[model samples]
Target: MKRTIFQSIREYKKQSILAPVFVVLEVLMEVLIPLQMAKIIDVGMAGDGNLPYIIKMGIILVVMAMLALIFGAVAGRLAAQAGAGFAKNLRHDIFYKIQDFSFHNIDHFSTSGLVTRMTTDITNVQMAYMMTIRLMARAPIMIILSLIMTLTINAQIALILLITIPILGGILIFIAKKAHPHFIKVFDEYDVLNNSVQENVNASRVVKAYVREDYEIEKFHGISKVVFNLFTKAEKIVAWNSPVMQFTMYAVVLLMVLIGGKSIIFQTMETGELTSVIVYALQILMSLMMVSFVFVMIMIAEASADRIKEVLNEVPEMQNQPNAQKTVKNGDIDFDHVDFSYAGEGGNLSLKDVNLHIKSGQTIGIIGGTGSAKSTLVQLVPRLYDVTKGSVKVGGVDVREYDLEALRDQVSMVLQKNVLFTGTIYDNIRWGDENASNEEVQRVCKLAQADGFVQEFPRGYQTKIVQGGNNVSGGQKQRLCIARALLKKPKILILDDSTSAVDTKTDALIRKAFREEIPNTTKIIIAQRISSIEDADQIIVMDDGKINGIGTSEELLKTNEIYREVYLSQVKGGEDDEK
Candidate 1:
């Protein structure tokens, strides 16, 4: 929390200064007013007829009070503005940093963990900043200034307070140290609760389908209960400080009254001096209590700050080289003994000693059973996850040597799980090429066989898609994803089981369009359905993480057992159907 507080203060250094300055002035006003009160009682009342001097002092106190109020308000406004502005920018930076993270970094943290960091964690830090500016700043200044003022009044009475202040300060520091760890635990529980809730929400359909509503509810309740328990424990510890400080102050006040009354009766102190001394003692104690409250707030902020720093300090796995050269497309890809893994989990290689070459304008097909590493192989082309061993080259140059954006621009992938943002059909399609025209969208939509259904909607291309494109059917979503990739007109296009949802007729139409419209592009199709890639110029059959066979459909049927099995499973009267 100290780290998060410092980070926020560092972000808005100018505004933080205003808080302390205003607090100092406010404390000075408070200290001076008591001195003026003593003067009015002792000097003004003692005079025979100097009412004007008393009136003047009263006016001066009022003016000083007004100035303090004005400065306090100004400082408060500045602090609020700074805190809010700092939070807004920090949230924006965290979000953008998450977006920039490569797959390696993304997989390290859960979605819920990242969400918690961005939202709940940041909010906690923001609250701490606001509270610090509003109360924490004034607390210390009041304590110090009141102490200085009290010391000038009566050394004996001030000496008693001096003893109590250190004891109260010691209690504050001890509680702060213990409470810091609890705040950390509270935040961790927050993440757990967020993760459970997010998982349940995303899988609500599955929960309903499985009729496991009770099970899910029980799971959520368990997580919520743990969060509540942690919160209660932390709050209980924090709640002790205020009451303890109040009780301590009460004890000190009673002692001061008894001792002060005896001093006045014994003529060691005058009546007005006794009254002034008591007022100063209360002021000093009250200020110390405020300081204690500030200490508590700082402890919490310090914990929050540390959590935020962990995220900001994380080093991204992938970063562009200094003055990296942009890839100049020669339309070729070569994989030379490429090996990769998800991270940690040891070297369970996704692609091992694999070699492949794709020249300009060639269409290649990759087919394999589940866990065969097809998607992982294609993902390397765009450098989504860098290969742990061996080089993946684009246009005769290693992909690592090229600018990341330049490398990505030459390749377009329609992932197996098609994702669509909320927008009009045209806008979604235009995502492939932000500057693509209406004609280009229509051409690709027609080629992908998506035009027929898109035209059926009331607004046709202008129809608004809901979040994740849930408004459309699965097949429609796949077609739109395909259309989006097509609009890029990229040099290398990867269709990863993108046609799985579409019927054979629509798939055939899309394949035909690919041949005519994108014949010059290097295409890699990863499919489970044999028919989807059976007619490719070349097909690579994979088993485990290695390529088992590389050949045309007719050649593979006679040579590769895995390819033969896949073919036989999909096509009845198999070899004869090829004729």
Candidate 2:
């Protein structure tokens, strides 16, 4: 985990190292200042009537103080740069890893949970990092140097600190252990709160439609209360450090004043030396307090580190072989005795023993009930999920044997959920082919039956779409998504209910355009309405994860019971509605 996280410090390594170096210089100057004060008090002020000696000490003291301020400023600047850079690289790493994750990997992490890890968790780690480079480096060095200076002044007084240091250290360690679990639980609750906010905002229309605004408010308040309670518990554990340090610090100071006062009265220790000792005692205790604060921050960041490492360490479930095939010559797809379980080999299968083949340019239609695994079958051609047994071959090559990008590039899929980003219509459509010419974009939009309405808008294809295309009608969004897929000019195009929102007339026109203009592109249309696939070269009927029937529309209507029942229900219903 440490190795994975620290690797993100790539270009920031020098800054990370140098920040602490400056901190060391600053600590050295601070330690020397106390000693210089002692010298000025004991010799220049008390023993010497020489003005030059006092003036020299005063100048030296000013220079050291200035150097300390300069070092501290440089250290702070470097620490900020290093910390921000580390966070930037870490966010990049985690986001890239998430992009490579398969559906199975994504299933293990909630959207809100991943969002928290990338944001809140990384912010915590960044704060800890800045503190580590600045205060963390200075504290230990300051403590050790101050202790040595105190010992030089008087060992008996210093021994009192030695005993107090161990007791304070024990108290901090105990608080840290108790506080850590609460912090971890607090971050988990944070994920829940973010999830609630995200879900509510995305579904605000639905909430208001059903008049459930009050219910959503109550739910959000409950999650917020959970977060508040967890944080309060964690902070309660951490709050012990301040009082513990103050009590121990004052205890040591009181003892030093008693012992050193007696020694001064007996003429055994100078008043200047006793003054320096008190200053050193405060410095040492302040350093310990800084360490305690750093410790608490570290305890919090430890959980964030684990969450980040989980994303970095997750291996993609499927990978191409080394020196893999890079070309897909055609759209011919063959599913040979394929068996699949989303849960891996041991889990219950979602697709079982599915065998089918399609020629390079043939149009195939798939129809099935809600749980018949229709989408599962089409997803395999793009290598979205590997079959648990047997093989799904595209272009006569096993998907795993080909480079993932090269294979996916040849297959354009319009998923069941048609999505449009917040951009001009042209920009969204051009996602299918980044360098598509204006003429080509217009041609595809016409073929998808989207050109007419798009042109009706004032700015035509340049009109901006709201997020998720909510500003547009559902049928319009579907047509635009279909146009986007058509722009790909891919070897195979799979539309998984992409035309469901469009009216029957528009859907028929889009399919007619496909048959006429892109006849050579293999089309796999997954549809709920029989009319959508009725004209395909062949149709597949799936039931309970297996093929129930495969034939032309007329043949299936005559010979297949399931197909016959669905066809009569749809066809007669249409005629009855006409009457």
Considering every candidate listed, which one attains the maximal lDDT? 2
Candidates in order: C-alpha RMSD to true structure: 2.8, 1.4
The local distance difference test score of model 2 is 0.91
Please give, for residues 1-579, the per-residue lDDT of candidate 1 as tens digits: 544336545567788777777767777787777778777777788858469878998899899889888887888887887778778877777777777788888887788777877777777777677777767777766766776766776677688888988888888778777767777787777778888888787677788899999998898899888878876777787788888877987887788778778877897766666676777777776766666666766676666667667667767877888977685576699999877877633667877889999897888899999999999899999888988888999889888888888888889899988999998999999988899889999999998899999999999999999887878999999999999988888889999999999988788888888899888888899988888898899999988989999999999999999999888877865557787
lDDT of 2 by residue, 116-228 (tens): 99999999999898899899899889888988988988999989988887788888989988989989998889889999999998898999999999999999999999888
Candidates in order have lDDT scores of: 0.81, 0.91
TM-score of each predicted structure versus truth: 0.93, 0.98
- Return the number of clashes found in candidate 2: 0
lDDT at position 302, candidate 2: 90
RMSD of 2: 1.4
